[model samples]
Target: MSIQLVFLGTGSGKPTPQRNVSSMALFRDGELFLFDCGESTQIQMAKSVLRPGALKAIFLTHFHGDHVNGLPGLVGSQTLNQRHEALDIVGPRGLKRWLKCLRELNILWPGFQVRSHEVTEPGIVFEHPEFHIESVALKHRIETWGYALVERDRPGRFDLEGARALGVPHGPMYGRLQRGEAVTLEDGRTVLPQDVLGPPRAGLKIVYCTDTSPCAGAIELARNADVLVHEATYPGGDERLAHERGHSTAADAARCALEAGAKKLVLTHISQKYVRPDIFLEHARAIFPNTVIAQDFFELEVKRRDD
Candidate 1:
C-alpha cells in the first residue's frame, strides 16, 4: 500500500541543460503510472527508480511535444524488452487519432496490446479495486486535463481481543468479522462487524495539473488534495506572456493551491529563462508557505493525512 511520486523531468518546452522535460511517475501498490512522457523520458526513468517494464499506464495532459514526444521511444523500449501485458494510454480527444497516425507511420510498434482512451468530457475515467481516478478539463491553448488519483478507504482496525471474547475460533470466521462481516458462533450467538472494528481510515489523494492557466476546473479537481502538483511555467513580471502562452505564473499556481485548500503544492514545468528558480518559490511562498519547486529526480512518499 505504498504511494510515491518521482519527478523525472521538470522543465518546460524542451530539455534544457539543467532539466529534461515534463514527466513524473506515481508508483502505487507496485504499479507505476506515468504523468507526461516528454523527450528522453525513458532515459530519465533509468536515472531514477522507475522501471520501464513495470509501467502499467501513461497519462498525458495535452499533445504538446514537451508533454508527449517521448511516448514512442518508451513504448519501443518496452516492446524491445519483450513486454506482453496490455498497456493503457489515456489523454485528450485527439489522442486516439494521433496515436493511430503514429501506428500507421510505424512510429510506435509495441510488442504488447495497447489501448488508447480519449477523454472528451470530465468524469471518472479509470477505476480499480484499490483506487479510482478522476479527470477534469483544463483551459489551455489545446484541450488539456488535470487528474486526481484517490485511494479507496481501507478497513477499520480489528480488535483481536474482541473477536476472541466472542468465542470465535481462530479461523476464517474471525477474519470475516474483521472484514466488516457478521459472523455466527456454534453457540448461536451473533457477532456484528462493528463490535470488532474501529472507525474506517481515510485514504490518500494526489492531484496533478500542468500546461494550463489557473482555471476553475483545475481548482475543483484539486480541492482538499493532500498534494497538488501544478505547473508554474513563468515567474513574476510576465503576466501577459504567461496568459498569452496559456501557461501559469508561479503566483497563479499558488493562488490555485490556496483556493483549492490543498495541503501542499509542488510546482513543476519550470521555464528555462528562470536561471534562478528561487524567485518562483519566493512568489509562491508569499501566498502559500507549503510550496516547493519540483526538480528532476525528486521523490516524495505521500502518506495519509493523519500520519
Candidate 2:
C-alpha cells in the first residue's frame, strides 16, 4: 500500500569525500527493488531496514562503473549473509557475460539465485504477482536504458452503507461482498457486489533514468509516473558540457518531468562540482516546481493525498 524510496548514494562518477555514486532502493509492500548498485551500496542498505538478501530484483541503467560497481559485492554478500531466494538482475545486453567474467575471477555466491536478463528492446523486463517492469532506450555515449515499475491495481473498498441499505447484515457476508461476490442472506435474498463495491483504482507508477541526455523515449517511458527519478548530472548553465558528455542538466531533467506528466521529480546523479544542491534544485524548480534534489540517506514515501 506504500512505496518507499531510499537514497543510498547520489553523486556521479567522480565521487566526492562525502557522497558516493548512484544507488537507490525501492520498497513497495514487503518486497525490495534496487536501482543502480553503485559502490558502497551494500553499506548503504546496511544502514536502512532493508535486508540485502530481500532485494527482489535489480535494474541497472548502464554498465558505467559508478552504476554497477557494487553488483559483484552485492551478490557476494548474499552468499555471505545466507539468502534463500534467487536474485533477478535485469539490464542491457552483455550483462550475463559481465557477471560470468566476474564470477570466474572471484567466487560465485552459492546460496542465492541470481538470474541475469539482457534487454535488447523496449518492453517488460521483469514481472511478479505484485509488480512489473518496463524500459526504453536512452541517448547516451554507450547503450543505456531506463526503467518504469508498474504496480497492479488493487481492488476497491466495499460500500458498507450500500450493503446495509440492501438489508445485508454486517457479518461474513460483508467480507464476501468486499471481494466483489454476491452473498445470499439468511432471508434467501441475494445481494450483488456491484451495488456495494466502488470502482477499482489505478496503482502507482515509478520510473528511473540515469546517464542520459534528453530523448523522446525517455519522456514516453516516464509518462504519468507518481515519481520520476531522473539524472541531473549538471545544472542548466552548461548545455555544451552536458551535450559533450551525453549527460543531462537540472533543466533537462525538469523538462522531462514536465513532458512526462510526472507528479514529482527526484533529481539525482549529481555532479561533484556543486557542493550545495540548492543551486541545482533552484534551476529545476524554475520549470518543474515539484523537483527535489536527491540526498544521501533521504527517503521519500509515495502515497495518494485526498484531493
| Candidate 2, backbone clash total | 2
Q: Please write out the lDDT profile of model 2 over residues 43-146, one tens digit for every residue.
A: 88998778775688899999899999988888888888778888899988999999888778766645766889999999999988877899999999999999
lDDT of 1 at 217: 96
Best by lDDT: 1
Off by over 4 Å in 1: none
Candidate 1 lDDT, tens digit per residue, 97-186?
888888899988878999888988999878889888889999899999989998888878888898888788899987798778899889
Give the lDDT of residue 91 in candidate 1.
92
lDDT of 2 at 125: 94
lDDT of each: 0.90, 0.87
